[model samples]
Target: MRVAISRCLLGDNCRYNGKTKPNAAVIRSAKNVEVVPVCPESAGKLPIPRPAAEQRDGGVYMSDGTDVTRQFQAGACKEFDRVKKSGAPLAILKAKSPSCGSDLIYDGTYSGTLTAGDGVFTRLLKQEGITVATETMVEEMHPSVEHPVAIVLGTGLGSITDLVHVVRRIDYHDIEGFPDNAQPIEGHRFEAAIGALDGVPVIVYPGRIHLYRGYSAAEVTSLVRHAFRLGCRDIIFAGATGAIPGKVEKGLGILTDQINLTGRNPLAEWEGLRDVESPFVDMNDLYSPYMSSIARGVAKDQNITIGAGVFAGVLGPSFETRAEVSALRQLGVSYVGMSTVNEVIMAHALGMHVLGLTLAANYSGGCDVDHQSVLATAKRYEDDFQRWVRGIVHLL
Candidate 1:
């Protein structure tokens, strides 16, 4: 894979301060790939040790109030052309510069305030449909994991297991804490496979136990514990969800964060609490933004329409009512489902990086919501879901 990166991140002294902001993590990630170094300011013929610039009022301006929009655009165009010709699908740029910031750039006030917008060069690359990430995002992409990635499939979404090359299979009954007489409902399976998907090591559970099924939080999360014991440090939780009316479309959605309305946590009075100093695990970034970014890139590469939003996990063996859906929408939820909340909580407590993928099988509060329809919808999109999961695994 070829990647375009900010020249300064590769240790070039090309910033306005004439100093390099070299990043070891970025360099390490680029070591094996063909790297195209880009310095938009330098390409614009801006001298070293020049005044710093920020984006404001639709133009680039120096700290001293001098307009440099033309030079910045000139440099961005020059570097963008080079990157375009290189055919690099990905670009890792500086986080907050007027020229290369991918996510947020400094506000024009020169007061160090960040506004949500891309830099000049980044905007050009995005316009051309290239995947743009920052140095921090790159770091998240390469987490330290020596074990296989774990995957837990939810109701009607177990077809992903068909694509795995199974090395071994285990019955869920043998897993500790699993119910003795556990039987999968229609559209789910009770088996686990240790295998490789597209040559990527993985341990896949074809179905999961949910809290609504008279299972304790600990019992519902047994698969997570087993995966952790097997040395898996990264896990993907894929499920079928109901789209929150106008908040999310009925297709694929990547979980950016979650609201646990299930009212039960896996770590509540569990023996696992003895191992950690505090039971209060920071829920921030619980869904792993790094993996989410990779998922977005995969969706873009494959031409799949996917939305990123918050998931509301409820305790449900039944679909939500109209009033319930309204409450969820007010909470900023895009997708709503039952299984992933406890599993995700347990996964995070175990220090595993998580990536959540949801298929919006139906619109919440729709009069036609039914299990049969959800299964039918899952069947319709199974091929795309498999492809998306495989693409993300390949990148990992």
Candidate 2:
């Protein structure tokens, strides 16, 4: 594969001060794959010893108050065309340059304050659908175990955390915009677990927020986004769901699709989602067929019967009424729940492969099941769930 790299990273003296920022790892990587070196500032005809520029208000400027926005844009355009014509699918860029920065840049105040913004060339490449990342994020986009699977443990399913040989832990409090005052549910855990599952790197979120808890869609699915940010590519959601009778049994299941009766979309409320090309992400194979196939094979190896069905997601702290259950049944929903789908949508939006494994805690119609019942069912299937997850991660 051909990859676009910042010219400076390849030891080119292309900076405003004519200094090159060479990266040894990036240079080593070039030995195996074709590297397309790019210097947007140089291409834009800026002098070798030109004034250092920073991104300000979506434009580039010099320290002496010269608004060289057009020069940077011209450089970006020229470099973008060259990179595009190279057919490079990936680009490793400088972290903070006004022309090559992928994620952060100077605030244009020339006071050394940093802010979230893309560089001129980087944004152009991304807008053209090329995968752009700063050198720091290169490892995540192409991990040694590509597509390392992640598990999002649902309510009563947090016990699965014990299965991980933890390498690192990130507290929910450490994440920005996370709610500190959200009411604590009995089975929920707020920390993140990062470790090896069956000798493979896997991340586990023991708790998640819900819409009924007054969280916006973004809040509810924050863990999913966090997992993706931390290098997990495949997400497996193990949650307690109510079974629709005569469809899937009161045990484990693999999701085929989902009905978002919850009437809310996490992507709808999310702004500045820069990584995605557009918010209209396709859900055609929303539930990953390849991951599901691995899960089904694993279940068969353990003599476990697995059912596949459409999941119905609703907004509720309350159980569905009988009439509501009947309506859901008519709509061909095989499992009903208050969570999972919104997170699934957000994961899909981020282009991560998804696998849904649900535990049918009870029959939805009139079981009158409480949270305790859900906990009990998860306990009963703990061993089986662990084995299934281990096998899937192994295959990934």
Candidate 3:
């Protein structure tokens, strides 16, 4: 686990006041993984304990209106690039800082009011597809609670694994291998273990409907509702996917942060919820650290090459053209796939904790598009993916 962290949070003695936030949770998580300490101010050539600054429309500026936004942005870029080379699956950054806040970032006026977005460095890291998280959210979710955990496998053989019981099994389609359409295979072998073992009530919704299935957005949204209604606080979407150019390697697991390039949205048709101003949930902090901690611990224990980064969701029945792939890569998508992002957005909007794990089945057809290769890889590594699922359940 290699994490990109704010220098201050790491007690680097480089803040404007020559002090650091240095959180205990951060220190513990860092010890579990390699830490890539970054201070955008220092990278921008600002001296230690420099004057405080704020971000304006053009750039970040000092109190006297000296423009430092360009320097800050450039410094952030350097740190972002440096951390990307480390290949750590996760990143823990400081929240509400001018450079590292995840969701409720400073309004850039230094007014002390958090707006509905992310900080400069956070946005850049997200664009680069890093699994960005804040220290505080992790502490809140993971606490020291003793929750039971279970691991589940997907696809056909996924139904049978090492488990004492099956909790629930869901087959989106009614086929011989699966049972019904709506109430299909409830409390089957797999889901039974998820509940019996995890104590958090685990249920599996296998064979999701894609854009190719002609499924309506609202119809798909109902699945998320059902998951939350089942007393499931956290929802994880684990599936097979194809790797995008420059973002990921084949046969690895990717934890996505956010997705919006696709025109489709799960909450587009949802009504009666004015609680959130928009149907789109701010994904600056999309993947939950609570879930990520479990993933990291499991990956370490099982020796899985779990790569976490930004996953760009494309509305695809058809794979992207090379030009399209190149465009998405420039946009900072580490991997391109069909599922998970939309579902994650819906889950977050509905106030459910969401985490996504994507198996890079094969490289997207930049020079090669082999369905045979993709399936072969998925088959070869199914157990590895299953083990990861089990780890998540165990930690839950």
Candidate 4:
């Protein structure tokens, strides 16, 4: 894959301080791939050890109150043209930079405050339909993967399996760690399919056991371990969710991050796994931003209106109370669901890339919410969800 990257991330001393922000992970990921190094500031003819600048008031400026927006824009345009001509689909930029930040950058006071916004070059690349990521997202990009992607569906979303061209099937009872006597819950299945969806290799688990079903964290996450053991390195967790009123509209959404309100960690519960180097796993980027970007890009191309939001995973066979719903909304949660948290935690601990997709089947704290209604609502989005998943797999 050809990727455009900030020159400084590859150890180029092109910053205003005449120093490089070398990242080992980014460098390692760039191996064997076509990399186009770019530095907007240097391309603008800004000298080494030049005045440090920040974006403020819709413009770039030096700390001493000198405007440099023109130079930044010029440099961004120059690099944008070059990257576009290279036909690179992705760009890995330096985070929190004045010209390269993709998600957040300095608030322009020179006080080290950060704000949510893209940098100059990032904006240009994005406008041209190029996917932009940061050094922090490199690990999730995995230049290539020979293993099949895993798809674990949660309540009422099992229809996605119907689109797969199956090569084989496995009974849940035969899968190690899966409860032998466990029965499938309403709207769930108890089988796994090894198949290809849209010509992409994949393993599909049509349903999962949840915490409220009296399953241990390890039991709930057995699918994750099984997927990893089956030579899968990427997993997609899709489920039904309750949309918080006014926070997210009822439909399909992508999980940006998650709050594990279920209060359980699979690393602490799964003691049989002896391969874990450490139980102390970093949760940052657990819901892969790189994959999420791909999902978003597919959504745009397919004309599917998918919202992005934070998910709160709770311990539940029962629906949330009004007060609980209010608390979750106050916590900035856009969707509330009963699954995916433990599964995601286990996937991350096992060194797998995760992408969480959700179906907002109902409104949280609604009086008429039930499993039947949730399933019915999910059916309304079945076509779009299938198309969305297929597009994502094709891209992967």
Stretches of candidate 2 above 4 Å error? 1-147, 274-277
**Residue 262 deviation, candidate 1, in Å?**
0.8
Over all chains combined, what TM-score does candidate 1 have? 0.73
TM-score of each: 0.73, 0.63, 0.57, 0.72
lDDT of each: 0.87, 0.80, 0.63, 0.87
Q: lDDT by residue for model 1 over 1-396, one digit each (tens)? A: 567989899999999999999998888866756789999999999878988899999999999888999999999999999999998778889999998886789988888999999999999998997877788766654533348889999878898888989989999999988899778887789999888898788889989878888898999999999999988888999998999999989989899899999989889946879887877888887987657766886787788899878999999888899999999999999999988988998999888889999999999999877888889998999888999999887776
* Residue 264 displacement in candidate 2 (angstroms): 0.6
RMSD of 2: 12.1
Worst 10 residues of 1 by lDDT: 137-146
Provide the lDDT at 382 for model 2.
84
- Candidate 4, position 200, lDDT: 75
lDDT of 3 by residue, 179-252 (tens): 23434122113232333433333555544545545555555555566565555566677656667757778765
Off by over 4 Å in 1: 1-146
- Candidate closest to the true structure, highest TM-score: 1
Model 4 agreement with the true structure over 1-396: per-residue lDDT tens digits: 567888999999898989999998788756735789999998888778977799999999988798989999999999999999988778889999999998899999899999999999999998997878888766444323357889999878899888888989999888889987789988899999988887778889999998887889989898889998998888999999999997998889999999999989888888755666655888998897678877886787789999889999999878999999999999999999999999999998888989999999889999868889988988888899999998787666
lDDT of 2 by residue, 183-221 (tens): 548777988888777677778888888888799988888
Q: What is the Cα-based lDDT of residue 293 in candidate 4?
A: 71
Prediction 1 global C-alpha lDDT = 0.87
Per-residue lDDT for 73 in model 2? 93
